[model samples]
Target chain A: MLEAIINILSWLLLLAGGAFGIIGGIGLLRFPDFYSRMHAAGLTETLCAICIIFGLVLQAGISLLTLKLLLILLFLLFTAPTATHAVARAAMIDEVEPVLSEDSPRLVDYEDRP
Target chain B: MRDTIFLIVLLALLWLAISGIYKPAILLLGLASLVLVTWVVIRMKIIGEEHNPTVFAWRLPRFWLWALREIVISNIHVARLVFRPEQISPRIVYQNVHFQRPLGKVIYGNTCTLTPGTVTVQLTKSGTVIHALDAKSADSLAELERRVHWLEGETDEVAAKDAGEERR
Candidate 1:
C-alpha cells in the first residue's frame, strides 16, 4: 500500500513538472522580448527541473542513486542562476533595452539620484 | 592548516561516495589522486579566509530557506505574468547595494537573477542594474538586497548610511 502511494505521488510530480516545462516553452516562444523570454526560460526551467528531480529522488528512496540525484539538483540550482546572470549581463552590455509599456515608464535611477 | 585538512577530508569523502569501490588498487588510486590534488591546492595558496568565509556559515542555511521561499513566491508571480503577457511592464532600474564584500554582492546578484521577475543585468561597484518585469518587481529588488545584506551580517548603521546616501 505504501509503495503504491509513493509511486502515485512520484507520477503526479513528474506529470506536473512536465506540464510546467511545456508552459515555459510556450512562454519562451510567445514573449515579446529577450528579457521576458529569459524570465520564462530561466525561472520556470529551474522549478520544473527541481520538481522532476525531486520526483526521481522519491522513486530512488534512500540510496546512492538518491544522493547522486540530490547532488545533480544542487548543482543545477546553483549554476542556472549564474548562467542566467551572465546572459543578462551580456544583454545589458550589448545595450538591449527592455520594451516597457508607455504608461509605466518609471525607471528608477537611484544611483544617479544621489 | 585547518582549511587544508578540511579540503583533503572533503575530497576523500567525495572520492569514496563517487567510486563506491572497495578494491585495494582502486582505493590506492583514489588516495594518490587526492594527495596530488591537495598538494596542488596547497601550492596554489588558494585556501584562506576569503575562499572559506565561515563567519557567515551559521546564518547561511536560514538565509537559504528564506531565499527559497522568495524564489517560490516570485516564480508564481512571473508565471502569472507569462500567462497574461499584457500585465508585464518591463523596465530597467538601478539599486545601490552597500555590501562591503564582493562575495555578498555576487550572492545578491545571483539571488536577484534566481528570483523570477527581476534579473541583475549589470553589477557595478556603484550599484546593480536590474531588469524587472514591473514597478512592483523592481521595488522588491531593494528588499532582496537588504536580505542579502542581513545574510552578510552587516550592521544596521551601514545599511542606514547607504539608505541616506540614496536619499541625496
Candidate 2:
C-alpha cells in the first residue's frame, strides 16, 4: 500500500512538472518580450525538471541511476540561480530597461540618494 | 592513410548496427566495418584528449541536474510574480561573447537557447546577439556563463597561456 501511494504521488508530481514545462514552452513562444519568456522558461526548468526526475527516481527503485539523478538535481539547484542572476546583470550592464507596471517601486530614486 | 580507412570502416559498422536487421552476413559486414574504422582513427590520430569521446561523459547528468534546480527556483519566482506581482522585471537585452573558439561559442549560445527566456538571435566572429526574455533571464545567462567557464577549467592561467600562444 505504501509503495502504491508513493508511486501515485510521484506520478502526480511528474504530470505536474510536465504541464509546467509545456506551459513554459508556450510562454516562451507567445510572450511579447525576452524577459517574460525567460521567466516562463526558468520557472519551467525548476518545476518540470524536479517533477520528472522525482517520478523517475520512484520508478527506478533505488539504484545507481537514482544517485546520478540526485546529483543532477543538486547541480541544477546551484547553477540555475547563478545563471539567472548573470543574465539579468548582463542585461542591466547593457542598459536594458525593465517593463515596469504603474505601481512598481522606483529604484532610480534610491540610486539618486547616494 | 590508416585514419581514412578506419573512419570509413567505422561509419560502415555504425550504419550496419543502427540498421537493426538480424542478418548473419550483415553482422559480419558490420564487424568488419568497425575494425576498419578503428584502424583509420588510430592511424590518423583523430581521437585525442582534446577530441576525446570520454570528455563529455558527464555533461548529460550535469545538464539534467542543472535543469531541475532551475525549475524549482524559477517556479517560486514565477509564483511570486503571479500572486504578489512584485518580483518580475521583464526586459530584453543583447550581450557580447567572450569565448574564442567556435565550439565554445556555439555551446554557450545553444545552452542559453535551451533555457527559458533566452534565444540566440545571431552569432558572429565578433560576438553573439541574444534576445533575453527578461532582465532576470538575462542575468541568469551571465551567471550560467561563469559556471560554464568554471566547468571548462578556464582560469587566469589558461587565459594567459592563450595570450602567450597568440603573441607567437
Candidate 3:
C-alpha cells in the first residue's frame, strides 16, 4: 500500500511539473517583450525543475540518486536567477527597451538618484 | 586562508558525496583535482567570506524557508498570468537597498529574480533596478527587503548605521 502511495504521489508531482513547463513554453511565445519572457523561462528554471526533480527523488527512493537529484535542484535554484539577472542586465545596458503597459516612454535614469 | 580551507573542505565533501567509489586511487585523484581547483581560484582572488557570507549564519535556514514559500506562491501567481496574459501589467521600479556587503546586495537582487513575475534588471553602485510583471510583485518586494535586512543581522537601518556598517 505504501509503495503504491509513493508511486501515485510521484506521478502527480511529475504531471504537475510537466504542466508548468508547458505553460512556461506557451508564455515564452505569447509574452510581448523580452523581459516578460524571462519570467516565463524562470518558471521553468525554478518551479518546474524543482517539481520534476523532487518527483524523481520519490521514484528513486532513498539512495545516492536522490542526493544527486537534490544537489542538482539546489544548484539550479541558485544559478538560474543569477544567470537570468546577467542576461537582463546585459540587455538593459545595450538599450533594449521594454514595451511597458503604462505611459512611461523609456526607462528613467536611476544612476544619480539617492 | 580560511576561505581556501573552507573551499577545500566543501570540495572534499562534495567529491566524497558524489564520487560513490571507495578506492584509494580514485580518492587521490579527487584530492589532487580539488587542490588544483582551489589553487586556481586563489590565484583569481575571487573566493572569500563575501561569496560565502551566509554559509555560517544561523538565521539562513529560516530565511530560506521564507523565500521558498514566497517562490511557491509567486509561481502560482505567475502561472495564473500565463493563463490570462491580459493581467500582465509590467513596469520597472528603482529600489534603494541598504545592504553593506556585496553578498547581501547580490542575495537581495538574486532573490528578487528568483520569484516569478519579478526580475532584478540591474544592480549598480547606486542601487537596484527591478522589473515587476504586476503590482503585487512590486509590493511584495518590500517584504523581501525587510527579510534580507534581518538576514544581514541588522534589525533596522538605524541599528546598522549605528554600528558603522553602512556603506555603498
Candidate 4:
C-alpha cells in the first residue's frame, strides 16, 4: 500500500516538473531581452530539474541511486548559479544594456544620485 | 596538510560511492588516482584557509537550507512573471555590501544569482550591481544581503546595537 502511494506521488511530481520545464522553454522565447530571458531560464530550469530529480529519488528509494540523484541535485545547485553569473558578467562586459522601461530609472543613474 | 588529507578522504569516498566495485585492481587504481589528484591540488597551492572545511563545517548545512527555501520562493515569483511578461520591469540596481571577506562576497553574489528574478552583474569593492526583473525583486536583495552577512558570522543584532551606540 505504501509502495502504491509512493508511486502515485512520484508520478505527480514528474508531471509537474515536466510542465514547469515546458513553461520555462516558452518563457525563454517570450522574454524581451537577454537578461530577462536568462532569469526565466535559470530560475525555472533549476526548480524543474530539482523537482524531476526528487521524483526520481523517490522511485529509487533508500539506495545508491537515490544518493547519486542527490549528488546530481547538489551539482546542479552549485554549477547552475555559477554558469548564470558567468553569462551575466560576460554580457555586462560586452556592453549589453538591459531593457529598462521609462518608468524605471537606470541603476547607474540611481547610484549616481547622493 | 589537513586540507590534503580532507581532500583525499573526500575523493576516495566519492569514488567508493560512484564506483561500487570492490575488485583489488580497481581499488588500487582509485587509490592511485586519489593520491595523484591530492598531489596536484597541493602543488597548485589552491587549498587555503578559505577552502578549509572547518571554516564552514557547522554553518554550511543551515545556510544551504535557508538558501534552498529562498530559491523555492523566488522560483515561484519568477515563474509567475514569466507567465505575464508584461509585468516585468527590468532594472539594474547597486547595493552597498560590507562583507569583510572575499568568500562572503562570493557567497552573497552567487546566492543572488541563484535566486530567481535577480542576477549579480558585477561585484565591486564598494557594492554589488544586480539586475532585477522588477522593483519587488530588487527590494528582496537587502534581506538576502543581511542573511549572507549573518552566515558569514556577522549577527544583525550586534550590528544594529553598534549603530545605535554610534547614534548616541
Top-scoring candidate (lDDT): 3
Model 3 scores what on Cα lDDT?
Answer: 0.85
lDDT of each: 0.78, 0.59, 0.85, 0.82
Model 1 spans with C-alpha error above 4 angstroms? A1-5, A102-114, B1-5, B32-55, B155-168
Give me the runs in candidate 3 sitting further than 4 Å from their true place. Answer: A103-105, A112-114, B50-56, B156-168
Whole-structure CA lDDT of model 2 = 0.59
lDDT, residue B63, candidate 1: 72
**DockQ, computed on Cα atoms, for candidate 4:** 0.53
User: Candidate 3's residue-wise lDDT over B54-75, tens digit each?
Assistant: 4638778878888888988998
TM per model? 0.81, 0.50, 0.90, 0.87
TM-score of chain A for each candidate?
Answer: 0.89, 0.81, 0.91, 0.89
How do all the candidates rank in terms of TM-score, highest first? Answer: 3, 4, 1, 2
DockQ sort, best first: 3, 4, 1, 2
Error of 3 at A52 (Å): 0.6
Model 2: what TM-score? Answer: 0.50
lDDT (Cα, tens digit) per residue for candidate 2, span A1-114: 999998898889889878777776766666554445556666666667777888889988777677778768756754764566567556645755555434333222212311
